[model samples]
Target chain A: MKMTHKRRDMLVGLSFIAIWIVGFAALTLYPLIKTFIFSFQDVDITVEGIVTTNIKFENYRALFKFDLNFMDLIRMFVEEIFIYVPIIIVFAMMIAVILNQKIRFKGVFRSIFFLPVIIVSGPVVAELFSQGATTLPLIEQYGILDIVTNTFPESISEPLEKMFSEIIFILWMSGVQILIFLAGLQKIDSSIYEAAAIDGASPWEMFWKITLPSLGNLISINILYSVVTLSSFATNDVLRKIRIDMFSPDEGYGYASAEAVIYLIVILLILGLFGVIYLILRKRSVRMS
Target chain B: MITTWHKIKHKLIGRTITEGILYKVFIYLLLTSIGYIFLFPLLFMLSNSLKDIDDLLSPMVIWIPSKIYLTNFQLAFQTLDYFRTFFVGLSVTLLPAVLQTFIASLIGYGFAKFKFPFKNVLLGLVLLTYIIPPQITMISKYVLFTDLGLTNSAWSIIIPASFGQGLNSALFIFIFYQFFRMLPKTLDDAARIDGANRYYIFFKIAIPLSVPAYVTSLLFAFVWYFNETYIAAIFLGGQVPTLQLNLVSFAQSYTALAAANQHFFSINEGVKNASTILAILPMLIMYFVLQKSFVEGIDKTGFAGGE
Candidate 1:
């Protein structure tokens, strides 16, 4: 209770250090290593027991095997990012700008938009965001992609129609971005806006120059978070279906792990790319000042 | 008229209500349009709930309820396993929420108050853990729980949650760390002079002051775990159907209600609406009450630390 500062400091440091290390090792590092190792070895998950045998690079090969169609799995992620990421950023920025403006019931709009983060799974809040609600209505109104191909040129309109339909579904998933944007908007200093207005900057110009630049850090975070979330949303039902369609026990369960590893590697590559990009952006921000 | 630029200036400070007739009308319309977007879904869901089985099942149920059918409420509840499922889900949700929040706070306090070596390293690992999808952790967590014989039991959720690995916990630690830093260190110093130990200081001096974080964390964890999918879905899918999982039945049944009408429930349109209403009733009620604190709690998280 009444010890020298040095003794107290030593005691606190030692105990805290021990807990931090042990906790991290048990909770995080162990799982990372164990799971990585498990990816290579054959593990029977279906039965009551499993055996771990070194399959070497066999798992990796089987992932790309003709029957498994490993490339398609990667393609799913690529296709997802191509169509989904742009839509998320654009819509989120738009909503944030509106909310940032002086408006009545500002809090109401923020909460409604932020609702998705709380209930991302449609099934959970079936009351609020029924899976069928938005997507179904849009498809109904537009009559799906079939309507497009029927009425318009196949080459020009077909891809656009498909992309449009996909985007409508993704909008239901933008709750997290909304929250991040709200945080970002709160951080933008009012003095900057004042300076811009004094300089006779139009609202549009202000948004393009000051608002977007100020949101750089948050935009980066939101983008990374959105990508990670969308990928994992590879629904359990989807995984189950894939397994049932492709499961072959005697083949050592190599192909699926290979597919998992491929996606894992792809994710790592994306994160690495993002890390470099963030450093560059931070440097730019520093230099701009 | 000098009205064009004059109207724009008022909006910059926070908009002026009294303007030229044209400007006033313009402001009203713009406000209405934005407000309409927010109200659209609520209105849509409402009308859909009212529609009769025939119209609700019809793809035409897109705009309005067409023919109101109040009975849908009764049926959806039955399909959702109303009383039994809700109670089980509620009981399961409450306990884990309480446990998870306490553990998260403990971990958060540990990180915030104690000046530990490898502190940054530990925090970094937690940040990296966010990158690791919970889906990826499934098989490993499953194996561990199964080995401990916690499969399909309450311990399955509670034990892992206690480890402070849950996102809710880590985020709270980030939040709590900031909140703790803002608190004057005098409380701890006073407690030390009083011969109080760490546990005593935490519970008596710190926790009493951290009520906002505690209440908000409770609400956050409860709302989240209540709606949680992966862990509850895979772990308790067969044993105990949580509130979220129970809605799956309607999803399957409603898959092809009215092909042309899309969302129009087949013959049981009323049941779908009722199910939706019942399932979200708790969330809606709770949201209205703690809606202020809940939003503020999340917004407060790690904000005071950034500066």
Candidate 2:
């Protein structure tokens, strides 16, 4: 009896996918479950095996009450997300539009802008900053720091300086977003623009009516990517603090897992906010058009 | 100057120089300035690496060094044991990167071409991997790896990737799926009509057409693996130091040795700069060499965001 074509295809497909199934089960799914289990327990790893003692909400309580410093860090991270995500999205969109233009040596400019993505790792940036090479020397030479200090109160000036530094870092992080937006821009059919122009659409009108609406999906993707990447970065002191506690002598595994779980929730919450906003904007655009 | 500018502008924009030459100039100016900001770190590293003790002390010395010095590079190279660690890094990175790329391609092809049971669920599971922060899973994984006696070995990195579960493997699969799904079904159908087996079709047709996906997965896998010191520290520990780890540990070792020898020498910023520069040199070179395909890969991988 001839095997059904559907069965044959399914069998072949399963064979190809079998390894990933096993791998994901072992690497991702299993570990995820185990992490959740470990979060509520007092876990100790020895030479022989893992020893898990099921406990109450003590680890989590400690996470919130005494250790982890959850509230302040989470608030700061949320604020940073709110501040940086929009800036990165807008900045990346603007740069991508410029790069997408019929400019000369576009490849050269593309490579230059993309260089940071390849080379800017945590240690490299930390190393550079340690050596007092964080900002351009020209800024120092021009007494920009002095002017800023004089202009603002100390409370405002400190965060202002930090915000300025973060802008540079966020600009660096926008490389991949720029690439994504550029690709999205290229995917828009030129005929749409030609039609708009025939209907006497100004460039400004075209951008508002056509370009922004067309790029709606990409903007959401950029926001999600930026927020997620920003949160997971090793340089993120909140995550770093959790990681440190993970390996530290007193807290060890369980406490870190609790912190990790909380941090994970925080990230998901932020992602959900952006995701919902994206959905609302998409709905509005559809209704308007 | 004004009349010539006006004439050129009128000819070009049909109105004013404000919208023509000035606009173009402003764009170039903006691009150059932002490009400089992006280039600042590398420039800072390079210039600082070449600065001597005297040049470093002189407040006047900034962007360009007064005198170029090779001593820092020489010292960092020696401390890092550049050759030994280079081979270690290559071994750890190359196998995992290549294996994950191949595995991702195969899995991605499966999802794209075949309508099997729970296909959507499986694909959703893959997306779940991307969303789940690695920190939560990392500790449990350490416990698991240690139990399996895979910790502190290159296999800790390579074995997971061999099964298509390496770093950002989900993103790789997403990219491969996007690339493979774009191919016309006629090609697969024609091959099948000729009695080509599924494996043969995948190898001969699908794999061959996926150059962009392959490059995207491979290059990114390699770079992420190379730069990954955190996971390496957790899994490999101190057994095998990849180049980045070596660069990080260089200062501690230097201080220890200097203290042991009772030397008055202090760790200078120049040497630190040199280590960073050298550590990132390979990635920099790879980016420049594969610049065209790299750009295309990045452009293509944007679809990983999905509709």
Candidate maximizing DockQ = 2
- Best-performing candidate as measured by lDDT: 2
DockQ of 2: 0.62
Q: State residue B95's C-alpha deviation in candidate 1, in Å.
A: 2.4
Q: Runs in model 2 with CA error above 4 Å?
A: A1-3, A46-48, A136-160, B1-19, B257-265, B300-305
lDDT of 1 by residue, B33-118 (tens): 64454444445556766777677558766666666667676556555667888788865577778876787677777777877556
Tens digit of per-residue lDDT, candidate 2, span A110-188 = 8887777787676776676676566766677887778878999975676556556555677888888888888889988
* lDDT per residue (tens digit) for residues B1-307 in model 2: 9999878767666443224666788889999998888787778789889988888788899778887898888878877878888887776787799998999999988998888999999998987777776766888898889889899998889988888778778878888887788889999999999999999999998888877778887988898788777677778887887778887787986676568654325678888888899889889999989987777776775463465
- TM-score of decoy 2: 0.93
In model 1, what is the error at residue A48, expressed in angstroms? 7.2
- State the DockQ of every prediction: 0.30, 0.62
